[model samples]
Target chain A: MNPRTSMMQGNIAVAEGAIAAGCRFFAGYPITPSTEIAEHLARSLPLLGGRFMQMEDEIAAMGAVIGASLGGMKSMTATSGPGFSLKQENIGYASITETPVVIVNVMRGGPSTGIPTLPSQGDVMQARWGTHGDHPIIVLTPAGVREAFDMTVQAFNFSERFRVPVILLLDEIIGHVHEKVTLPDPEDLVVIDRKKPTVPPEEYLPFEIDETMVPAMANFGEGYRYHVTGLVHDQTGFPTMDEVKIEMMLNRLHGKLDKYADEIIQVEETGTEDAEIGIICYGSSARSARQAMRELRDEGIPVGMLRIKTMWPFPTDRIRAFADRVSHLVVPELNLGQIAHEVEHASCDRAEVVRVNRITGDPIHPEEIVQKIKECR
Target chain B: MDYQKYLRNENFPHIWCSGCGAGIALKAILRAIDDLGIEQDDVAMVSGIGCSSRTTGYVDFNTIHTTHGRPLTFATGLKMARPDMTVLVVTGDGDATAIGGNHLIHAARRNIDMTVILYNNNIYGMTGGQASPTTPLGDIGTTAPFGAVENTFDISGLVIAAGAAYVARCTAFHAKLLDDLIRKGIEKKGFSLIEVMAPCPTAYGKLNKKGSGAKMILDQKDAAVRIAKAEKMTAEELEEKIVIGVLVDRDIPEYIQSCDAAVAQAMNARNGSA
Candidate 1:
């Protein structure tokens, strides 16, 4: 039998996708553009024997998500701009503790509540570095409604598998947009659970890792009775003042993602095999970039596009290889060249990076990108 | 009591200083848990960043030493996720009343099933001698070289007004009473707040000429008035007295049970519609 298709909003699709991914707990504070995700879960989760809590604030919500994750539940929280800022401290705690959680940050105008009701891709860098620390995080951005559902599932899977906090970065446009999404059957979709310790409780070291670089997680009440702390800890899960252990732990945290970048990093390239000019963008702006790419190609201009799905653990190698094939690459986003700077760094002088920027809480139009592409030509 | 059974021996030489009342409070908690026979794996202790927050490091339970001022929030999540597990929060005065005040009130308001053991040392012990929210007016702290000008918070009253199901106040001097209150708090199936008036001799004591840690603990004994006697005293008569005992205890709907009921109702509504 064919899967049932339904008309759904982007945030609703994300909430449904979380339920499909076996997320049993959601703790969130209501925020503009992202509040719908919480509202949807509030009504649906309890009916399915899942827990939904509207925490007092964003920080509390983030804390609750990490707490639930440590208790052996697939947990998540959603927020927008200012709320995201409030959650950074606990987000850092989740990072240092190697807790598996999914945070949905719906992009909005920022630099302190700039615009609440409109669209802007201003949190790209913040999602990458918002939490102050040299820690590992996986971030995924989805352009449309269906991708939003798919990426939410992928976010949970990656978080559980890597035992790292995963971020689903969405923009106001996609969050509010309504579209037809045919969700996959629960059986067909890939669902991953964090690896549990095989050793007896007495011998288990909470932070010990093998070649995978990701340690097996033990639930709070699972008789592990282990300790978890935000302070730099050794394999025994106890804080250590030894410099060598601190350095080793930090490296392991970063190396876990670096070694598995091939599995974590994802990018979609269209018409980029033989092109003179390329466009690189993500989230909502990628929609306009794709339109411009198709229009330019149809007009007989050698143009292609690289759409970023995984924003962190950035596809640097792929961007460099693409730049080697193209003379110019246009990086257009809703912010002031956040990703453009990253593209310039990644392209490594192989391509002259041109930036088409927008910061008025409005979607970047295809005409705007087409005009920029023509200027580059 | 077999203190070693509940203690993580490797983390010994704890950060608490000599005469630090937090050690006494920790002992009371361990004794309470031991008396109640809560399994090591069944209890989860969470603490914020402070000298008192160090309690989790020495405990053998499933413990987490979380960020500054946020142990209650984390405990709320852990409790909601695993309702079967007993959750306890250990926080300092500054950690709970200053930075984490919002969480403290909200947790009480939600009436979640958890026990909060608040160590009110009246000053920030770990970060030098800074005046905390519980620091009394005119008490000298490093931040208040002359004297603390700000009025202090009545923590137990705050939790009571915020709708906690159980609220108690005890002092490190009242070690036996502290253990009994904690045992009752753990047995209470809703949000329980037990504010322990722990002394900070190195910080608040030395700055204010409160003599030694033992002397400061003895002062708690003189200042405390049992709840029954204090009820009949006038405001002026009770001004210097720290009313110590169970201040609030009543039956209320616990958060997790309400959540389960809401879920059942929702499922029933859906089934009816189908």
Candidate 2:
């Protein structure tokens, strides 16, 4: 048999990339845009000696991924809007407890199952704040199928590196798009496993702060035992109402994330140094803006593009640098005004952030972004 | 046995009142797990938010404490991802029957391979003793100060209709029987729900004149009847009676098996082509 790379869609590549990333356990129920992921994993996991479970619902699917992660397996579950809401509580638990699990929420138009097949980037805010409480989250948005594959690997790696749940926010447009992509051979890929505590089982504190700010994990059946709860917890994973412990735990949680925020944040610039107008977008919206940038550049409009790879952890510094370089920044998203709200704050009166909003179960067309760019003049 | 090894080090000694039936239920569940010799790593003890939900933190075995009424969904996920492991969902009547009612029905209807142990204290214990979905009518819970006008839930019958492969009911009063039922539920292949009728001695017990710890167990004495007798009894005769025994046990198609088959078929095809 000859080994060669083949063209594959973004969702399929994510399943294959998960295989490369050593994700052997997958639990998901089929939902639009996310169904291909469930299908691909369902077909591939068994061959790789992994497990695949099509749960009865998305709620269980999310829970299973977290449970499997605890069982010494890299696991992920994929879903869209409504299913994302269902997984919020456990996602929060995974966030605080620092459970290394990957969740792929393919954004679709929705307050409640609004457009199952259509594409919209309405979940940007939900990805950040859907889970109750004040826990720091890691969310990555993939603009294309290739990013879906690459970012999924990064999601697993970040989850392992930081010991937190990593969200890969993809939209229905890219999730369903058919594209030719190259998947690296398994031998060429490096997978990230959860950092097991090297400390003696007796000395292990599941949530104790270390040099990396990530607490070491004591896998089930291992001798070092611990308790973990959703309540404000101490270093030992026990519930603590003490104001000091509360402050310490919350601070550690936030500090672990924002302290190295520079390392976790990712973005791409098309042309901002010598341009006066800017287009800031993510997910599929960025795809259209990339096309619009070329058209605008041809038309003699000095507009540039800044595509966010990491949506949460905001990349405020990168935004600031862009804000300093540009006169006007345009934010285009499927929501009425979410990411624009963040950009406005990060700009902090330095730059005027204009929103190109799209609430319908459709993406912001390139012409619409072009219109926004024309207005920037 | 080092039972304490299974409980979370932080939430030790439990928060149950002296005579609370949840403590008895917790002990029975731990014992059942021990008697079965399930490995600590091989059991993912899932629980929904409630007094019983706290059991996950207390017990070891890859515990997952989810939001209110969502343990079965979580357990179903865990079981699907790790079919070789035992996934047990520990939840209360209010958590499982009220907010999580839909998930329970669907989990049973599909017969996902997971064990759900319901601690039916009849009243919602965690949220200040409100009238739960299973609260007995005419009882006085915090939400029902003028006496409950709502009819109580018969979980076993509903579970039977929802197609749970194994369904059983037991009270914390009958420790041995309750433990046996839990063991049986654990051993079942598909979705098995064992509703343990626990007591809220501090909250619900005092109001119903359940007296003390020992007297509460005594009150459960006459409420239980054997399955053979119950099969012949009429509805009126069964009323005011809490039958304790295995209610439904049958082999059914498990969700995990079906998933495995798809994976297997795909692998076989790939191997043939290769």
Candidate 3:
């Protein structure tokens, strides 16, 4: 088992990664391109003494994940397109309550179930702002099956550490794409659990925080007998409408992620040191960007690639520097410039930002990106 | 019973208005929990958005005030993960029958071990007297100025059809009976739904000319008939009468236990193969 290697699909790898990360509960509703994740966990979790429930709908699935998280289990759920839309309310609940849970949105074309069986990175912005209100959330876009596995584990760790909901944003291609990879031994993996209250039940305050900005969470039925609510809450974890307390609560939620943005943001860069043309992408779209960059560089064109892993806390500084160094920056996503707009904002007039978008329910091929980069060059 | 033992005194002067039957229902629930002798630490009180959902904020258990119409889903997951704990849900007519109808039926179908205390206020009281699924036909609400044309939901009958192990209906007027029914619902090993027919004096009562909270409760007392007595009445006689008592109680394989058994079998097979 030390040299565990296998050909696996992206969704299967996520399930495997969840198992390895000690996620004891999974509640999900089946949606195309993401159904395999629920199916895999249904077969695997019970064997590991973990719980898997296929909820009535995506909203219920998200609610269940948050509940199980409160019950002291690392929990997750998966869905796509319209299902992701259905989950936004509960996702908002998890955000406000600061419950640790993981959500996997296997992106497919959609305003409403546009194309279920096809690939698209259309949900990138929705991952950030889908849940109503201003709240803190982490979104990770995995580019391949291996990264899906690695990032799923990272998602649980981040959610536990920050007590924030983490979204593993995968596209249809990534969900179904099969890749051969050697996964690390379980003994060698780094797993993180939510910080528990060190104080006695009488002294415990469920939402109190120090410099870490993340409160120690006491699981339900642990005798800490605390309150949890979606409403704006004070340190006591009860609802509050006092203006000062509301501002303080919102500030801590946003500030926690912002304070550690440097450590939380992850990206991989290649050939950007001397290249005049740079392509910035994530998820399966980044796969095409890498191929396009390699092809262009071989043709004596100065091209580079920056693939984003942590899509939220958005790596603004790194992307800004990359944009500044390059004369032209190309953002190739399945949606119409969701991240390209962010790149344009991050570029801050330092460079020309061009978007190569395709929403035809098909993956953007390397050639399309190559054509865009060549045009910019 | 000492109410202070379970009540979160800090959250006092609760959001429930004067004459709101939610307070009555909450007292009955605490009394039932007291009767069962379950520790406050082991009882998880969950609720959805509504006047009833605010019930969690008043209690000192492992309380969770979840999104609208979604407490049962959350409770289901919590119970599945922590089967050692007793999970209870407090929901409203609008929350349970309209927005969260699917979860209610499915939770019953799975026969999960949970006791649901549904407050049937007949109108969306929190939102100011809007018509809900349980608003009786011809009743007036903010949304139904003339008269409500939509058919009302028979909540107990719905859960019974959906396979609840225990189903009961009791009005806020019958405080002792409500307490007993809640205790019975909690004691049942599978899904239990105890619909508490509560009056919303400020909203539903005002709009429908249903008199003050006390007067409405008196109306409930007059309309209520014990199920044993109602059994002898014909359908026409039973119409417009509230049949108050445990409606269904049966033995069934509880969901969490069945899941645990399956997990054990799978582990055993794996060990045997290894």
Candidate 4:
């Protein structure tokens, strides 16, 4: 029989996607536009033989997810802007310790609790640099309800494969929108389980990096006892102040993503084969850009759209290549020039980068993006 | 018993001061785990930032030394994920009650199965000396230069009120009793808190003129009253006394067990509907 189709809300779709991805543990404190995700998970996870817990606060939620991940479960937590801000410290810890967990941040207007119920992509840069220090992060932004489902599953896969925290950046628009989704079969989806240590318990070192720079993980009760901490550490996972070891560890952390950028970074392009103008967008703004590109193509203007699915590690090489082909790039985002700045830096003075920015608690309309594309032309 | 077998010998001599009670507390915990014959791989020792939080680093087990004031939260997650493993949280007074106070109460309320060994030195021993939530009202510290004007917290009473299945208080001076209680706490199937009123000679002692480390530990032994004896005494009569013993020990549904039951029930319901 064919797969079942149902009308699902974005938040619910994300929850279903997580269940499909084999996420057996979820801990989160509710926040607006993201609360539905938690509610749905709370109801659905148990039915699927999973655990969902409401923690005391956002910090505890993040901490719990990390602990669960270390205990050999695919874990996740959902939050909005304020809660995401509260989670930065533990997020940093997850980064340094190489814990495989997923964080779902449904974006809203915010420096502090700004427009909790409204749609805005204001957390684009915060998703990249909210946590302190030099660390690598994988952030995927989904443009629609279907993409939300697909990317949530991908988030878990990437986190498990790389042994790093993955952030699913969902704007309030995509999180709250309802759409018809055809759920995929679990057997058809590519699910990656964390690599367990092949060495004996006495020989296992938690932070021992193999050729891939990603260490195999052993769960707490799995006979491979080891230490995990936030401090800069050596292969034994003990805290060290040695400069050489610290440098080597830091490089390995960054190298895991840097060397694997080809597999990590993903972007979707349309009509860019022979185009003079290209529109750069992501999240909800990508929808507007796609609409505008279609209208421009119908009008016989060769304008293409490059929608970023993976926001961090920045997709610089692809943007630079696009810059070489297109004469001008018009970037539209909900925030005032966060990713636009990166686009300009990546273009390397090749393509003229013009930003169409918005901070109002509303989606960037296709007409506004069309006007920018025409201006770029 | 050879306690050295459980310790990460290369990581020590530890960062704790010469006369600090955290070492004594750590020794007692190791003894309890050893006495219980729990496997090293089946125990996960979690600690937050403080002098006491360093316990995870020195122990040869599955350990996690987490960020400040967050060990209980992490322990909750670990216990929930692997309910079969014995999870222990080692936190100091400031790490447990001051910054992580909210987590403490919530965890107790949920009655998650974990043993929390709160090393209460009555001051922030790691950061030199600063006033802590459990510090005496008239105690002196660097932060409380003259004297502390704030009231202290009865952490045992607090956790008992918050619905922990097992709550106990002991001191570094009472090593045997502390060890016994820790063993009991570990055996319990819900949240168990053993608040150890440990000494900080380098910090709280020097500032508050509480005598040398040996003398302070002696004072703690003298100041403590058995819970049964304290129950019969008047409030005014027990003013300067610390009540030491099991404050609450009873059976309750554990958090992870309850979650597992919920999962089973939901699955069963779904099956019935199908």
Q: Give the per-residue lDDT of model 1 (tens digit) for A1-377.
A: 34569888999989988998999899999899899999999988877777899998999999999998999989999999999999999888989899999999998887798899889889988998998978799999999999999999999999999999999999999999999878887889999999999999999999995788999999999999999999999999999999999988999999999998999999999999988999998988999998898888889999989999999988898899999999899998999999999999999899999999989888899999999889987
> What is each predicted model's overall lDDT from 0 to 1?
0.92, 0.82, 0.92, 0.91
TM-score-sorted candidate list, best first: 1, 3, 4, 2
Encode model 3's per-residue lDDT on B159-269: one tens digit a residue.
Answer: 999999999999999999999999999999999999999999999999988989999999999999999999999999998999999999999999888888888987889
Q: Quote the RMSD, in angstroms, for model 3.
A: 1.3
Q: How would you class the docking of model 4?
A: high
**Cα-based lDDT at residue B230, candidate 1:** 95
Candidate 1 structure quality by residue, lDDT tens digits, B184-230: 99999899999999988998899989999999899999999999999
Off by more than 4 A, model 1: A1-3, B272-274
Q: Write the per-residue lDDT of candidate 3 for residues A1-377, one digit (tens) a residue.
A: 44588889999999999999999899998899999999999999887778999888888999999999999989999999899999999999999999999999999888797988998888888999998999899999999998899999999999999999999999999999999988888999999999998989999988985788999999998889999999899999998899999888889988999988987999999998988988898988888889898899899999988889899978888989998888988999999989999998899988899999999988889999999887875
TM-score of each: 0.99, 0.92, 0.98, 0.98
Docking class of 1: high
TM-score, candidate number 3:
0.98
True contacts kept of each: 0.80, 0.37, 0.79, 0.80
Question: Which is the winner by TM-score between candidate 2 and candidate 3?
Answer: 3
Candidate 2 deviant stretches above 4 angstroms = A1-7, B1-10, B37-42, B60-62, B110-114, B251-274
lDDT of 4 by residue, A104-142 (tens): 999988769898888888888888999999888999999
Backbone clashes for every candidate come to 0, 2, 0, 0
Clash-forming residue pairs, model 2: B7-B58, B8-B58
